[model samples]
Target: MDAQVSINDSQAVLRLGSRFDFKAHREFRDAVESLLGQAGSRNLQVDLAEVTYLDSSALGMLLMLRDKAKATNKDVALVGVKGSVKQVLDIANFSKLFSIA
Candidate 1:
């Protein structure tokens, strides 16, 4: 997976590539976590349009990030989800945990 992180003001956007699975989990987590930690943003938006597959580990990773953002009084949003990826999030009831669009 590939990721592009961009920030403007207090908001950060993470553009995720296809196939967010266990193989890319560590690197993805590190990049996202670093940005969320070092930046001054209170909001994070994850773009998932390119994602084609998302496994249990990926779901867990998202949950972890959501919880961390909440604990810091920040917000996390999952955007551009589609197909199987969207199904995974829907089945897991992630819409209630974070903003989904």
Candidate 2:
């Protein structure tokens, strides 16, 4: 996966592309950390529209981000989820954990 981050006054948007799997761990973490470090960012939106594939490790990573964001009083949402990615997330019950759009 590849992560590109953009931060505004109230939120940080992380646009992810390609396969979001174990190989994405470092990139994902680094992006999340950078977003969380911005004091003005109180919300995080992970854009998965460009992601073509994902595995269990990707789910785990999202969960980890949710936990970390919550600790910092930041809300996390999964945006542009569709296709197989949407199915995987639904099966994992992520809708209950994140605001999906």
Candidate 3:
């Protein structure tokens, strides 16, 4: 996966591309940590619009991010989710755990 982060106002947006699987674990974690460390960022948004695939590992990573962000009093949202990625998230019941858009 390719992860690019940008700070927009009070939100840190992490845009991910390609396959979101086990191989992306390290990169994803690093990006999430960096976003969380941003003092001005009160929200973390993960953009999965370019993602073609995602696995259980990716879902786990999202959950981990949510937990960490919560501890820091930050909100996490999944954005630009569509196609198979959206289906996977729906099946996993992620809408209840995250603010999706």
Candidate 4:
């Protein structure tokens, strides 16, 4: 899995690659960590449109991001999730825990 993190002012966007799993741990965590360093209300968006798969480890990573974001007062959002990836998250009841768009 690969991740690209971009920050604009207080908004940070992390674009995921084809797969989101244990391989993405470092990149994903670093991207979320970037948001924690910013001040004020931060918009941390995880773009999963390009992601074709999401393993259990990926779900765990998302949960970790949520906790870290919450601690720093940053807003966490999952965007562009569709197909199988969306199904996995839905089955996990992550929709209730996160704002999916």
**CA-lDDT, candidates in order:** 0.86, 0.95, 0.96, 0.87
| Model 1 lDDT tens row, 1-101 | 99888888899888889899899888888877776775589889999999998899988888888888887888889999989999999999998888899
lDDT of 4 at 58: 95
Residue 99 shift from truth in candidate 3, angstroms? 0.7
TM-scores for the candidates: 0.92, 0.98, 0.98, 0.91
- Stretches of candidate 3 exceeding 4 Å from the true structure: none
Candidate 2 achieves a global lDDT of 0.95
How do the residues 8-63 of candidate 2 rate in per-residue lDDT, one tens digit apiece?
Answer: 78989999999999999999999989988989988899999999899999999999
C-alpha displacement of 29 in model 2, angstroms?
0.7
Instruction: List residue ranges in candidate 4 displaced over 4 A.
Output: none
What would the TM-score be for candidate 4 when compared with the true structure? 0.91
Please provide the root mean square deviation of candidate 2 (C-alpha atoms, Å): 0.6
Q: 1-101 in candidate 3: lDDT tens per residue?
A: 89999998999999999999999999999999899999999989999999999999999999999999999999999999999999999999999999998
Worst 10 residues of 1 by lDDT: 30-39
Identify the superior model by TM-score, candidate 3 or candidate 4.
Answer: 3
- The C-alpha local distance difference test score for the whole of candidate 3 amounts to 0.96
Supply the TM-score for candidate 1.
0.92
Which clashing pairs does model 1 show?
A: none
